[model samples]
Target: MPHVPERRPESLGQAAYRQLQEAIETGALKPGDRVSVNALADQLAISRTPVREAIAWLETDGLIVHQPYLGRVIAELDHQMVNELYALRFVLEPAAVGMAAKNATDAEIDVLREMIAFERSVLDDPIERERHNRRFHNALYRTAHNRYVISTLSALQTPMILLGPATASDPKRLLDAYAEHTELVERIAAHDAEGARAVMMRHLTGGQRARVSYLLNQQRS
Candidate 1:
């Protein structure tokens, strides 16, 4: 007989956090929308305690802000915020990729390739594709062998997730992104640190453009 692993049930706080996070990510909870803790708790069919806890956690991640009179609201993204975020990414991700070129083992590279394939297979499903996209970047972060870089990227995930409708949602953009990932992986496999960094810079710059365009379109709509 095969042994089965035990499954741990999610705590109310954890469940609330995930639901709230998804709402933010999909734009169901749009930026600048105020949060009503009791209202959300009632909507989730959970008590206020867990909902409050989730909000607190999100606040720490800079996903939600608490104003004196306005209460809690989703963090708004502007052109300046977008530029700052990408600038930070520019400083961090390229260096991480460069280090990954030197540090990632063949098995780690294989995992990244598998993630890319997974993303391609989910083209018809934006939600799954987005999940896989994050997974791929996270895999690369872990491959870098730097704890501070990994932690910083992890913390950034909250704000990053709030950017809805990925540029890869378009078929052409999806193909371009996949091609870029392929080239990046190739550069890493060859242990070309500088080449990997260059590819990463291009990738991030393109993504920043796409994100800005998406934000502008959202505003116009």
Candidate 2:
């Protein structure tokens, strides 16, 4: 039999970009970790060009900093950045949930219910519970039928992971969050746009409080 041609792997640059992005999102690349282009290329079995490109992309996204002679390092989270992120969420998520109430189909509501059930089942593991919580919120945003809202919310996911663990780690916080989600879903199901929006605002507010408290405690320590 004639030898078959092997399929080409993804471009080295694309692979490098994806791997680096995941590392940044999952906290594997912590703040201030130096970005060694040569070492990254060697480790990922790629070339210098791609690693450089990946670094450039991260720099543009403000996830990494480029310093003269010092090279690039993962960017640190600051108070202002955290405030701005939650502020943006406060403006956007309520609107998305309100719109979802008006436009979401019966099938979408069913999907939301399933998401809630999944979240409830994962309450013992904070990380897994948070992941499911994020999924539920993302699904609500998607159901809003607004492309920009969905895009903006999706971009916030990496920053969320960087906030250091879930507020749902506390049993009380987790239960309260679940109740808020349940109320929001009920409002959506009933086509109560204003009610859903109010619930969403409260949800985001509670989350912001938890995250801010965590950051403040970290500073104190």
The prediction achieving the highest TM-score against the true structure is 1
For model 1 the local lDDT of residue 23 reads 91
Q: Write model 1 residue lDDT over 116-189, tens digit each, in one string.
A: 77777887777777777787888888989999989998766557777765545667767777788888988988
lDDT of each: 0.85, 0.82
Identify the runs in model 1 with alpha carbons over 4 angstroms from their true place. 1-8, 166-168
* Candidate 2 regions with alpha-carbon error over 4 angstroms: 1-11, 67-69, 166-168
With candidate 2 superimposed using the best TM-score fit, by how many Å does residue 169's alpha carbon deviate from the native? Answer: 3.7
